[model samples]
Target chain A: MSEFARLEEKLAKLRQRERIAGEGRKLRGKGGDALLAALVAEIDETILPRRLSLVTPQGPVHLAVANRRLQALLAPVPGSLPEGLADHALPDIEDPKLAELGQSLKTLLAEAENIPVTARRLDRAFGSDIGVPAVQLPRIWTVAQPTAAKPDDILSGFLADLGDAALAWLRIEGEEVTLQGGEEAAVAALSEQAAIFLDSYFGKFDAAYREPSLACGTVIAPADGSANAVFFVEIGEFSAIIHAPAAQMPSIASDWQRRVAE
Target chain B: MDITAELDAMRVDVQGCALVAYTDLSSQLVLSTSAAANPVQEEMNALSQAAHLALDGAIAEGAAVSWGGETPAELAFLMTGAEVRLFLRSPANSSEALIAVCAPDVDLERAVSEARATLARIGGQG
Candidate 1:
C-alpha cells in the first residue's frame, strides 16, 4: 500500500478507538447515574425521612430517637454536644435514656457535618493519610469568609493549627495502621475521631452561617497491592503517594506545600 | 439602483445561492433571493430569532450584522464539533430576525460582517 493509504488506515483505527472509548465512557456515565438513583431512593426510603423526622416539630419522631442512639454509639472518646444542637431545644421526653439519645444524635449530626472540613484541614496540616482510617472517608465542609487576613494567610494559619492534632494522631497510630477498603471497624474508629474533632471545630465557627460540604476519600491498602491511599481533598484534586509503602506513612507535608504553591 | 439585485449577485458568487432575504424591524423578510424551501430556511428562521435577542438594543439604529459558513448553507465545509442551530435578530426590531443553520465552525465574524453590509445595501443601518 502507498504511504498515504497506510496513514489513512492508521487514522481510521484511531477514530475507531476514539469511538469505542466514547461509548465506554457513556456506559460508565449511565452506570453512575443508575447508582446515584439507587442511592437517592435508599436515602428517601430510609435515611432521609428519618433525618427529616428528627428535624420536624410534630411526628412520631421514632427515627429521631433512634438516630440519637446511633449518635451515641458513634461518638468519639470524651464526647460532647455538637455545636449547633447545644442551644436547640431537646425533645421533652420522659425516658432518661431516650433524652440522652436525642442529645447524642444531635451531636453526631453536627459532628458529621464538619468531618470533611476537618479531614481536609488535617490532610493539609500534617499530611494526607497521616491519621486517615482504612475505609471510604467522607468529609463534610463549610465555606468560611476569609478572615481579616489574606485568604492564603488564613489557610496557612488553619493548616498550622490542624497540624498539631494530625501529627499527634499519626504518632499514636504509627505502623499499626493497615490498608483496608471499606473496613467497617477502621472506618468506625476514624469516624469517632472525626466526630470529636469536627464538633470542636464547628463550635469555633458556629457564629458564621454554615453550609454543608461533603467530600469522600478512598483508603487503599498495600495488602491489596494498590497505590497509597487516594485522598481527594476536594472534588477535583487528588493526593497520591506513588513510591511509599502502604504500611508506612506517606510524606505529604512537602507535597502539600508544592500543591499550594501551584 | 436595485440593491436586491446586487445582494443576489453576491449570493450567487458564493455558489448554491438560496433565498437571501433582508428583514425589517417587523421580522418580515423585506428582501430575499428566490430559493427553494429546505432545512437551511428553518435554520435561518431560528438564527434570526437568536440574533434579534442578542442585538435587542442595538437593532433600533441598525448595526452591521452577518453570520455564515455553516451547515445547510455553506458547501465543502467540515463539521467542526457541534452544529449551530439558531436565529439572528438585528437590533433594529425585536421582530426583525436573520436566521441560518450554520456549520459549527462557520466564521462568525465574517457572517456578521456580510449581514451588516447586506442590510446597509438595503437601506437598513444598525
Candidate 2:
C-alpha cells in the first residue's frame, strides 16, 4: 500500500510480461519446428510408402518419373524429419491443399515456417508488416519513364527504389545484383520488378557483348537487418551498380572511382 | 606518389600487369592505365568495373548483414580466369581502391604485396 511497495508491484508485473513475451517467441519457434518435423515425417512415413507401393519391384517408368519429380520439388525441405504430432497450440497447415502439397510443398512450408522468422527479423528492424499472403504476388510492369542516363544508372535507381520500399539493402555489380535483408515478400517483389525492368531496358539496346551483359542476385541477410539486401547490376563496358548498405557504399564508390581515375 | 605513377610502378613490379585502375565502389572508373589496345581496352574497362562492383557488393553483405553490429573489414577480391587474374583491394579507412589485371600465371601473393606497398608509398607521398 506504500509508494515503494506499489512501485515494486508494478515492476514485478512488467518483469512477468517480459518473461511471457520471451516464452511466446520460443513457443512460436518450437511450434514451427514441430510442424515441419511432422510434415517431413508424414512424407517419409506415409507418402513415401504409398509412392513406393506405386513403383513395382522392377520400377515402372511412369510412376518412377512422378516419384522423382516429387522428390525434386521437396528437395529444399529436409529429407529427414522426426515423427510426432505437433502441439495444436499454434496454427497447423490447415489448407486442404496440404493434401496436394505434392505439387507445391516448398511454397507451403516456406509460408508456414520461414514467414515467422522473416516477420520477426523485419519487425525488429524496419517494423514492416510481415502479414503477407502465403505467396505475395510477383511484380509485372513495364518501365514507362525513359531516362537519358545510361541503362545501368536507370536500372540501379529502380533497384534502389525497390530496396527502399522493402526496407532492404541492395548491391549491384555488373550484371549481378545482390539484395539482402527485408522480409521475404519484399525481396520477392524486388526480384520480380528487377527482371521486368531489365528486360524492358535492355530490349532497346544492341548487343553489347557476345554474352548477356547483365546479371542480378538478392540475399536476405541474417538477424537485425543492418546490411539487409544487396543489388548488383553490370552494364557491360558502360557502367555497373554495386549498391551496398549506406556505410559501405560511399567507401566502395570512392575506391572504385579512384581505380578508374588512374 | 600520385595514382598514375603508382600504377606505372606497379606495372613494372607486378608481372603480367594487363590493366590497373582506380574506381568508386559503384564500379565507376575514375582513372585507368592499361596495356590493352584500343577496342580491348574499352571492353576491359567495362568488365573490370562490373567485377569491382560485384566484389564490393559481396563484401558489403558480409559486413552489414551476415555479422550484425560487427564492422566489416576491407576486402581484396581475387578472381582467376583462363586468360588473366583480376586483383581488387580496397584499403582500410579509405574510399578509393586499386584493381589490377595480371596474367593468369602471375604470382598473386607477390602482386598483391607489391600493390599494397605501392599504395602505401602513394599515401606516404600524399
Candidate 3:
C-alpha cells in the first residue's frame, strides 16, 4: 500500500480500538453494580426466607460486613438486636451503589471473618498454638494487648491544634477519660463526664468493636464488633460520632481529623 | 449544702444559660432546677433519665469497649439546630449529672469550664 493509504488504515484501526475500549469501561462499571444487585436479590429472596426468625416475626439478623466495617443492615427480620442497635440499622444495604462498596459481598465476608484478632493477651501470655483443653467441655482464651497510642501527647497536641473547635478533649485512663488542658478541678469533672459516657456506651455494646474507626452517627450505630475493646470516636455537629481504632484515628477525614492531618 | 442555691449560682456563672438543672440520674428527679422558660416536671424527669442512659447506658458500654475497654467519654454534647444540650458527669460522683441548655452561639469552652467548677462543688458535698 502507498504511505498515505497505510496511514489512513492505521487511523481507522485506532478509532475502532477506542470504541471497543470505551464499551469495556462501561461494562466494568455496570458489572460492579450488577453484582451488588444480584447479591441483594439473592439475600432478599433466598436467605431471608430460608433462615427462620428466632426472635422477630420477619427474617433473621444479617449484617453486611463491608471489608472490616461491621455495618448494620436493615434486616427484614427484627429481633435479636438491642433497641439502640436496632435503631442504627441503615436502609442503604439494598442500594445498588453502596458507599465505597465496590468489592463483592463474598470477598468482604471472607475478609470480615479473617480480620485478625491478635488474641490481645492470648499470644503474649501463652505462645501461639499452645492452647489448653482441660476442666470439662474445653475453653480457650483469645483477647488482649490494645494498640491504642498514649493519649497524653496526642490528645494535648490535638487539643491545642483543635483549639476551640473541639467541645472537649479527653484521654481514657483505665475507666475514665480525663480531660486534658484543664485545671485540677476542671479535669476532674471533665474526666468524670467522659468516664460515664464511655462506661455507659461500652456497657451497652457488651462486646468490643471488631475493627477500629467505626465512624458512627448518633442515629446510625454500628454495634457488631469483637469485644469491649478500645477505639477512637469524634462526635460532631452532624450528630455523627465516628469510631475508629484508638491507636490510630478513623479515616473519615472530617473536622476532627484536620489537626491530626497536619 | 443548699442545692437550689448552687444551681442558681451555676445559672449566673453560665452565660446565656437557657436552663440549668441538678438531676439525680437514679431517680430521674430534678432536686432543684432553674430555666429561662422551665420545661414541665415530666420533661425534667425525662431529661434526668435520658442523661443517665446517654452517659452510662447500653451504648456507653459499647463505646467503652471501643475505647480500649477503659473509661468512656466524660462530656457528651447533644447539638441541635436550635440549641445545645450538655451532659456532664461529676467525677466526684456518677449518680449525678449536670444538664445545661444554652443558646446556639454560647461560648461552650467557657460554659464547660464554669459548669465543671460548679459540679465539683456540688459533687464535693455528696
Candidate 4:
C-alpha cells in the first residue's frame, strides 16, 4: 500500500478501537460489579429508607453499604485509611447471596489494585511517552491525512450544536436553589466534559450509540453533607455527564478510573 | 512534601512506571526523582523541552491540544532502543514537568493521569 493508504488504515483502526471502547462502556453501564456502578447503586441505596438497621443505645444505626464498600475498597491499604473508620463495619456475611456479593466486591477491589500495573503496560504499548509529541511533529503534507481537529474543538462544536437542547444546570448555593446552564456552564468543567465529549464524538462512527447528554446542572446540598447528590444524564448509550458536589470530586475521579480499568 | 514521596504514591497505582523525575525548566536540572540511579536526566529534560515547546506552540495556534492523543508529543522514543518515556507538563509552571519512563506495554492513560495527580498535589502545574 502507498504511505498515504497505510496512514489511512491506521487512523481507521484507531477510530474502530475508539468505537469498540464506547461499546465496552455501554456494557459496563448495563451491569457489572465494577466499582462505579456498584458504588453509585450503593450510594443510591443509602439515600433510600433503610431495609436493614441495627438498634443501638445511640439510635437506630442504619447499615451504610456505601461506607462498607468504601472500607472494602480501601481494605488493602488499611494504614492509609483515616482513623476511626479503620475497623470493619460488619461482623461477617452469613447469607449465601451476601457472601457471593462479598466475593464480587473482592474481585472489584482486586481490579482496583491492578490499575497502576495496567496503566504502565498500556503506556508502553501506546508509547505515548517515547515519541516526539504529535504537537511537535513537522507538518507533513499527505494525500490521506487525518483531520487536524483537536479533541476539545470537536467537543465544543458538539456542545454548541445541541443549541436549545443543551443540558440544563442547577446551582445549589448552600441550602438555596438556583438555575444555571448545564455542564456547559460549569466553571472548571474541562476534564469532566472531555470524558463524555470524547465518547460522543467517537460514537458518531458507531451509530448504534451516538446520542449525547450534557449535565443536568449542579444540585447543591447543605454544608451538612446529608442531602448531597450526583446526577447523571445519559444523552444516549454513549455520552453522559455527572454532576456532584466539589467534596465528592476525588471519589468520582476514582470511579472514572475504575471504569477505565474495566 | 518531597517529590519522591509524592511520586511513590502515584507509582503504586501504575505497575510499569519505573521512574518519576521532576526537572527544573530553565536549568534542565532534575530537582527530584523516584529512580535510585537516574542516568538519563539530561536527555529526558531536553526531549521533554522539545515536546513541551511544541505543545505550547499548538496551544498558541488555538489547536485545543489536550493530552489525549493516539500519539501525544509528550512521549519520547529513544532511537537507541530504550524504554518509552513520557513527559507531563506542570499545570503550575510551563517550564517544569514530571517525567516518567515506562515499559512498552504500560497503561499510558491512567499512568499519565496518576502522574498528573501527583504533580497537582506537589503544587506543580500539570
Candidate 5:
C-alpha cells in the first residue's frame, strides 16, 4: 500500500482503541464518564489540528494523525522500510466493540449535558468554626467567696467595664482571697495588684492571709484575720483570677476605682 | 451573663477571629469550663485560624481582583476544603474591612452581597 494508505490504516486502529476506552469509562461511574467527555472534548476542540506524526527507529514518519498511541505502534519500524512493508506489520483489524462503546459513550455524554446544574448549597452554613464544641475553661479556682454584692451587681459592674459578656468567679482559701474573671489578662493584672494590696494591708494591720501564685497574677486578698478573698474574671473565651487579703478588701476596691479612672 | 451563648452567636458571624483565649481555639471549648468529649475541636480551631489569616489577607487587598467579584475563591488543601473570600473597599463615607466565609464553591456574587449585609449589620461600612 502507498504511504498515505498505510497512515490511514494506523489512524483507524487508534480511533478504535479510544472508543473502547471511552466505553469502559462510562461503565465505571459518573466520574469516569466526566473524564471521557473531557478527553473527547479536548480532542474535538484542540488535538485534531496537525496532530499526527509518525516515526520509525531512525526518524519520524509524518502522518495525518498525531495521536500518541498510534505513533508508539509505528515507532519500532526502521525508517528505510517502504510504505507497503510497513503496512504489512500493522496491528490486526479494529475491534468491533469499539463502535458499540463509542455509541454508548456518546449517549452518556449527552445525558450528562442535559442534567441541570444545580446551585451547590451546604446543609449547615459554612463557618470558620462549626459543630466543634466550645473550649473548656481551665479549672483554676478552689472555693467560692461570700460577697455583700449581689450577682446582678457584680455582673453589671463587669459589664460596664468589659461588655455584657464578662463573668466572674470567686474562690476562698484560708486567710487568702482569689479573684478570677473571663478577661484573663486583665483579671491577672488585677489579681497581682490585689495581692500587693493584701500584703500591704496585712503588714499594716498585723493580719494573716495566704499568698498563692499558682494562678498567675491573681490577687489573694485578706478578707479578715481568718479568711482571704479571691476574684475571677472571664470575658468571652478569656479568663483571669485575682486573690488578695480579705482584711484589705476596702483598699482593693479603692485601687480598682483608681485604675478605672486612669 | 451567658458567655457561651454570646460566643456561639459571635462565632456564627465574626470574620477572622484572633483570640488570646485560655481554652483551645479548635474545640471552641472555654478552658474555664470542665473538660468534655470532642475529637475534632483542635483541628477545627487550627483551621479557623488559618482561614482567618487567609480571609484577612484577601481583604487587605481590594476585593475586585483577588476575590473575582462574582465568584469567591475556594480553599483547598490536601485533605480539607472550604470557601472563603474577602472584600475591602472605601465606602461612600468611610473605609472599612469586609470578610466572608462560605461553603466550598460559594457564588462570589452572593458572598459579596452577604458580606456587605453583615458589615451593615455590624455598623461597619464598605
Candidate 6:
C-alpha cells in the first residue's frame, strides 16, 4: 500500500477519537492502544505531526515517535493513559492531508539555508585549527578554462565542521543582527558577477519571501560529482543550493518539503 | 531517440513528474511537450527562456564554456518545495534544451541523467 494510504487507514481507525491535527484546537478520540501504537510505528520522521498528544487521565501526554523507535515523545504515562477515548490536536491534517503537507520530495537535500546575498560562489576554506582565519575564496577561476585549481571535495563534510571555528564574531544590537568581519563586504562584492548571472539566467522570483529568495549558482554534470552547485528553485520563497550525499537526498528532500508546507 | 517516447517514459522513469518539453532555446519556444497535465503557454515560455539563459547566456562564458572545470555543460536541474524544473542543453545545438517539471519528491539525479541523454541524442536524430 502507498505510504499515504497506510497513514490514512491508521488515522481512520482512530476516528473514534477526536483528532486535532492543526494546533491549539483539540481532536478527540476513543479507545485504541494498539491503533495509536500502530499509527506511530508506520509514520516515521518523514512526516510531521508525527508527534501527537493524548489528553489522558494523567494529563496531556505527548507521543513523539521517530525512526520507528519510540523516543522521548513516548506515551502511555505508565498507566496514566486510561482505556482510550482521548483527545488529539490534529490540526492541518484535514485541510492539507498528510500527502499535501509539503511539495512531496524524493531527494537527499537535507538542509537548505537562504543566506542574504545577490549570490556568488564563496568557496571558503577553514583551517582545522580553531581561531584560524578561513580563506574566503579558495580557487582562482580564469575568464577562460586556464586549468585553474578548484577543490574537488567541494563542501563535502566541510559545512558541518565550519561552526567549530568562528571567522566573524556575532553580536546583536537592538533589532539589527550584525556579523563583525570585513569578509561580509568581500562576499557582497563578489555578488556583482552573481547578480549578472541571476538576471541573465534565473529570473528573480517574487513570493511570500521572508528574505531574499532569488538566484542560484549552477553546475552541470559529466564531472567528478564533487564540485558543488546551486539550483534556483521555482517554488515558494526559499532559494538555496542543497549539498548532501546523493543517496540520502530523498528523505532530506522530503523534510524540506514539510518545512515549506509549514 | 523518439522524443515522445522519451517524454512519456518520464512518468515511470521519474516519480512525480507533471510535464516534459523539448524546447528550441534559440527562439525560446517549445518544439514538443509531454505531460499528464497541460500548463499554460506562458509557463512554457518562461521555462524556455530560463533554460536558454542558464546555458547560453553570459554566465556560461566563465569556465571556458563547459560548466567549469571537469563538469559537463549538458544539464541544469533544480528542485524546490513547490516545483521542480530540470533543463538539459544539447551540446549539438547550444540553443536546444529539454525542460522537465516534476514534484519535489522526484529522483532529480535520474531526471537530469535521463533528460541529458535525450538531448544528446536529439541532435544525432536517433
Name the top TM-score candidate: 6
True contacts kept of each: 0.00, 0.01, 0.15, 0.00, 0.00, 0.20
On a 0 to 100 scale, what is the lDDT of residue A87 in model 1?
A: 20
- Over A127-234, each residue of candidate 1 has an lDDT whose tens digit, in order, gives 221221101111111112112222223233433443321321111111122222233443333323332322222232211112221111111112221222211121
Chain B structural similarity (TM-score) per candidate: 0.42, 0.69, 0.86, 0.65, 0.32, 0.78
- Which candidate wins on lDDT? 3
Off by over 4 Å in 5: A1-31, A38-262, B1-3, B10-46, B49-101, B104-126
Alpha-carbon error at A98 in model 5, in Å? 11
DockQ of 3: 0.06
Query: Each prediction's DockQ?
Result: 0.00, 0.03, 0.06, 0.01, 0.02, 0.18
TM-score of candidate 1 against the unseen true structure: 0.23
Q: What is model 6's interface RMSD?
A: 6.2
True contacts kept of 3: 0.15
| Among all candidates shown, the one with the greatest DockQ | 6
Writing each residue's lDDT as its tens digit, candidate 2 over A1-262 gives 1312332343334333322111110101123234333223222211110121111122211111111011211112232211111111111233332333323322233334311210000111111121111111111111112112433454455444443333443343322333344555544444443343333223312211222111212221222224433333332222222324433432332233222221
- lDDT digits (tens) for residues B1-126 of candidate 1: 365564564444423334445444245334343333533655445433333322332221111111110111110111112322223343344355443333333443344445545544555533
Write the number of the candidate with greater TM-score, choosing between 5 and 6: 6
The candidate, 5 or 6, that scores higher on DockQ is 6
Candidate 5 per-residue lDDT, tens place, A1-262, comes to 1312332343344333332111111111143244233333222211111222211123433221121111111222333434333322212124332233234333433333322111111122222221111010001111112212332333336434543222333232221232334455544444333333333222321111011111111122221322334433222112233333333323333333222221
The candidate, 4 or 5, that scores higher on TM-score is 4
Q: Under the 3 Å rule for N, CA and C atoms, how many clashes does model 2 have? A: 64
Question: Judged by DockQ relative to the true structure, which candidate is superior, 3 or 4?
Answer: 3
Please give, for residues B83-103, the per-residue lDDT of candidate 6 as tens digits.
Answer: 556677776776677888777
Worst 10-residue lDDT window for candidate 2 chain A reads A117-126
Q: Model 6 chain B — which ten-residue stretch has the worst lDDT? A: B60-69
Q: Where does model 3 exceed 4 Å of error?
A: A1-240, A243-262
Q: Which stretches of candidate 2 lie over 4 Å from their true place?
A: A1-262, B36-48, B62-69, B78-80, B83-87, B90-93
Q: Which lDDT tens digits does candidate 3 get at residues A129-234?
A: 2211111101111112122232233444545554433333444322222344434553333334344444444333212221122122121112222222222343
